[model samples]
Target: MRNLLILLVFFATSFGFSQELNCNVVVNAQLTGNENLQIYKTLEKQLTEFVNKTQWTKRKFKPQERIDCNIVINVTGQSGENFEASVQVQSSRPVFGSTYTTPVYNVNDKDFSFNYLEFQNLTYNENQYESNLISVLAFHINMVLGLDAESFSKEGGDPYFKQAQRIVNYSQQENFKGWKLEDGLQSKFALIDNILSPTFSDFRTVMYNYHRKGMDIMSTNDKDAKNEIALSLAYFRKMNANRPNSYLTRVFFDAKAEEIEQIFSSGPSVDVTTLIDLLNRVAPTHASKWRNIKF
Candidate 1:
């Protein structure tokens, strides 16, 4: 198992319509024995540009309209040009009619092992594996866009999801660690697969409700917003029952747990006890966190 260190840094930059992600990329190799940090610094600069300047979607976005996400690469060891590391990816969007930003995706993947040459440009081709570093970064970027799209509209993320699946399919030819079918449940393969599966359609619907109907309306109508969120919880419970220990299911709650707890704890109209029982059933792994929600 690789040691993971997540350092989140936010970058606010003004850009014209083509850009879609306002991503912050950090490369930390303090734990590694190599004293020269210039290589890591170069990697960080290129990775940041790779994510932020890339025009990911056909639709245009203003500077402020871009999605916010963080990518942290923790270099654990190195043998010459080969670097062993893990990556933490997280993304969030602003809630409508409110100052709050809601987290939509979070994952710490430990299969990152790649070679880097200082000052080398990161290049990617959709149909080919240019580099393992670029492939992994591209895979997560598409997933972030896909999840953000699903939050706003029902199955609105289909195109992005399809693109991510394509990356997975083409990436199979590469001699990488995280792109294989049997890489376990929390693998990158399983995450995108679960999101695109018809059996997991209800989970997508709940995402729409949780963000659009619930978070978007919370400022103007707390009661109705809480009710909408509660209704979505039923769908979450249903998905959990149908597919136990789903990777997407775990991802969903990982992003929403703190927000959900705060909403119910602060909203007077919500039945905290009923929600406690429902949460326990659907997300038992988060039982300790749910215990903090009071009646």
Candidate 2:
């Protein structure tokens, strides 16, 4: 009750305009073994500022409300201004009452090839493609914001997702790997496209139910919360029956497998037998983590 009042008061009083994302951006060029680490450091600093400083949404957000996320650009090779890189994006949100924050979006996009010069200004234009660096970063940030919002309210992420889809649309025209349908099954195009497609609607439902219904209630009624979480996994079973191990499904389990194991392992006793079986079927890749579950 105290936390709720504090939050309500915060929202009511926080009329100040603030950045939407509290994100950490890292540029890891160690693999390249490049002597000129200055460029990579500069890239990291610029990206961190660009993402954290950009006002993603029109609504005002207090400091605590900023979405927590991270971006890591692994630079594998570089030649002149061109470079080969892979990007891993992760974002999470706080539970309603507890100090625990659940992972919401976790994805690593390979083939993030882009060109950059030292000290180049990074800017984002919603309607235009200035560069892959800007487009990819902005797209992920918006998607993170969208996912965070969806966890709180049903269909709350539509606008941000549409904006991300637009980013993909603009980026498809550019020379990039993760922005097109042909990039691979796990491409950024496939990620957002599958999410928005009615064929995979249950994915979004699981997002809402797993977070809002399940995790939020855990501190109050852990037993019921466990049941709610297990029920939420039923959406995955239905999605698997249709697509059978989809990219989006893999994406969910990628972020959630560890958390799922932890939740069901040492919490109030609940029948997760069906859940374990369903998980193995839908996300076989995480069989190892599922096996670690004692309960």
Candidate 3:
């Protein structure tokens, strides 16, 4: 990731675009058994350039401030230019005053099916409906930005999320599976809709408290930082009371379960008894990991 910083510096100095994402893209076609491997390589390269080179935000970010993320697309089938796939997108940010980089967003979109030709241009205009491929890439990039921002400040993610919502709105005209209400609970539509809805607003605060107020301060006082982190989980408890086993809660735990376990397991022994109970109640799906909290 450090090497990407040098490349980004060159980009900001050379091109006028203030690109904000340092994305590592992977296109896997092992399941397709398509002998024409060159096309997949081409697709990977083009998508890599599109994601890293395209400026997703208006705010200029220093090279080190660029968000670190990964996009993995597994190609299941290929019919000429049309491909059926699933994509996993995740992003992380460095903790202030620490070497740790914590996972912020980890989501898998299973309904990714797109048409692409090697060397074809992929472009995104928020107000327009382009290819599903472009829309999906743009959506995740904005989502990464939104989640990253939410970590820095309370609801700072709202602007980027609105951009993602716009992408969802226009992409709906194209009838993408992940952009509509009826696309199941795990759809991208439900994810962003829940975040923006005032009903689930506590989740955003949990982001700021958990990362900015908690992890960022860990180096100063592990006990106090852990306490702040445990207090943030109370927000999840309230959220679970209103909406049990929510898609948003599930998403949060997906990226956070392992880290939570590690944090409580090794840190200056804080009373995690209540925190453990809270985890079991709120993210019971991770009960196994919760059970592993030794301290």
Candidate 4:
């Protein structure tokens, strides 16, 4: 009996250790020429604060665990108009390592631009420069690190998207009128509304319905299947507005509702087969939840 007890203790310890996150991150920064050093410094400082303040899962990274990161500010012209900022981050998992790099442009008009890989025409107003950058960086890092990419994407991909959606959703509300800009304000709201309007809503509804139907088919007429499908269908119908025909939309929508119906119908429980199959269909080029999702 003592020997069996010792074996149990050992197994428990090993399992606990395996669940702990053991990874290192690093940050670095560099600037070119005699451009606005102050701007670059501010960017670096903000980026650092953003990462530190972010809750990267629970105990996934240690404060002392050397996060080697850098920012390079390059001045292509004598004037500051030709300035650009780039951020690169290196993160390691127990079984894999990855690198993510992104470049953000700050133009003379105080406008900003960044690439989202698939969609690149991202533009932000002068007043919202910092906020936009933070939103973009957070989205990029979350997507690359295999975090809740689907949730983030559904929530308009970042804070800016959510903010824009809110303004549109509550345009008739008393406070939203105050959100108007001094110039071309109508055009701005029009663009935002165009992206999140009825057509977009319909697309999301279709994806949600497809997913629910797939789940219903797989669940073998389980009583909870209907409720589970209803919940997921409702969520995506409200959330996904911009990504029509996206692989994320397809794979997630294609999942067997029956497989997930029980999990969603009951309390939280991991559905390993559903998750693995979804990841296999949408990993690498698109998004991945391999490290984060578990049974």
Candidate 5:
């Protein structure tokens, strides 16, 4: 009977592990223009590296995972000063015993220009330009989707469809002016507002207060205090879900919750100084709490 119970436990654990969604990604590039094919190849290589090298938290994915995705880049039009590119991203993931497939993103633009000389005539100074473009794109995607180190490290497990929705929403916004990109890098807050459905700033007040008084309350063994902190965390997470680039909130919640949980589990033996420091780190937004915190 004991052997059977252990075997069952092992099998259950293995089954649960196997059920985790896995993913792979393939990139397809098609360039149309008098431009050098080498340039397209370089772009392809850069993009591939970008996707592959990105770390998405702790959930790193293997190429042969159950989830699969593809990125198709079509350079459909080109003229001396006008260059057009279209990106169609497709993704598939298993959910609740069913496989869901969808277009993650379909964006086509004609005004963007890429100089072959940029790559071919590469100089140290020009490297910054390329880096800026890559950073902008990466930041945009990261904000549009709450991608962390775990998601980017995987192949198909990356949440591309959610990101697509953010892109669509941002594009439809009245304030969305393509001209803004011309002004150099946009503010992170603006990016968050643009891509997220709910404005992140809406929770700023609550989050700030939580950081101040909430942590101290959570340190107490009082059940009511713990529940209050939990409720606050839940609310913050929900609000963050409504906006792009709110992943930082998620991270903050995780860190704060873990600290609170540790204190609870350790009882009075836990280091109060450490807990205080953690609260202080998160208290910048809640000036009142910061001022009121005693020790």
Candidate 6:
């Protein structure tokens, strides 16, 4: 009877606490001071564990359902415990019916500065600002999940975005460097706020169609899939016309510019010139890529 109970316990433990993210954290310390290089190693290990182990949502994710993401931090300066760095956060989702994984969220955050002690515990409370280290990580983790959810369903990531906003709101009290509304338009607060605004709601729908309805069906019907994606480009034009050069617009281009070039490269059924004109209008930063897509 004791052996039977132990077997049941092991099985339950194995499946009980499934996390939602398989996140990789890398701290590039080549530019930092050598006196404390070992601490950066410790930071990388602890951060990886903290992100991968923490259950961000109550939903139990199977091993295969975990969102794939990477957070790379480039340490530029350090003074004792305080460090200044830039972070590039990226996440991708598997194309439905295809082996390709499409990039969803990719943004470079330049205002990440935090203080840390070697091997310190990383704990996060939604309502409190415990540490800038956890605040920055928590904020981006939620954003990744939120953006992934948006790709799967319309307005599906509202809860996660709200949670990210709550973190930003609570962190403002601590007077953190990157948590204020008045910070530059590219700050974390502005990013989340832009996502939650009603004017940008259509862009979320565009994301869903681009991934689920568009890319997912390309294997079976490449022409129709490309047409569906081309239809979605009008949404970008509308978004940009509504709010010219918004942060979210830039975020979309940052994530999809390369993919856009790939999708339209082979003279898709949709008018290539119209798409290029729209791309130039909506995402001028990638106009060169769009011009190359011209047939």
**Model 1: how far residue 79 lies from native, Å:** 1.2
- Which has the better TM-score: candidate 3, or candidate 6? 6
**All models: lDDT?**
0.85, 0.88, 0.90, 0.35, 0.39, 0.87
- Residue-level lDDT tens digits of model 1 in 1-295: 1222222211223334388998999998878966467888889998998888877888878767889999999999988789999999999999988889999999898989998998887776776777888888889999999889989989999998888888888888878888888888888899998988888889888989989999899899988999898888888777777888788988888888888878877766667677789899888888887888875
Among all windows of ten consecutive residues in candidate 5, which has the lowest summed lDDT?
102-111
lDDT of 4 by residue, 1-295 (tens): 9999999999776544312122222222233544445544554455455454454333333333323333232323323322233333333211112132111111111122321222223332322433334443443343333312212234322344445444333432322121234323223343344334554454334333433343323335433444444444444433334443443334333332323333443443434455444434433233333443343
After superposition, which runs of candidate 6 have C-alpha atoms over 4 Å from their true positions? 33-36
Per-prediction backbone clash count: 0, 0, 0, 20, 14, 0
What is the TM-score (0 to 1) of candidate 1?
Answer: 0.91
TM-score of every candidate relative to the true structure: 0.91, 0.93, 0.94, 0.28, 0.34, 0.96
lDDT, model 6, position 226: 91
Residue-level lDDT tens digits of model 3 in 114-201: 9999899888787788899998888888889999999998889988999999988988987568899999899889988988988799
Candidate order (lDDT): 3, 2, 6, 1, 5, 4
Candidate 4 worst ten-residue window by lDDT: 101-110
Supply the global lDDT for candidate 4. Answer: 0.35
TM-score-better candidate, 4 vs 6: 6
Model 5, TM vs. native = 0.34
Model 3: how far is 197 from its true place, Å? 0.7
Model 2 residue 34 distance off true place after TM-score fit, in angstroms: 1.4
Looking at candidate 2, what is the lDDT of residue 89?
96
The lDDT leader among the candidates is 3
Among the numbered candidates, top TM-score falls to 6
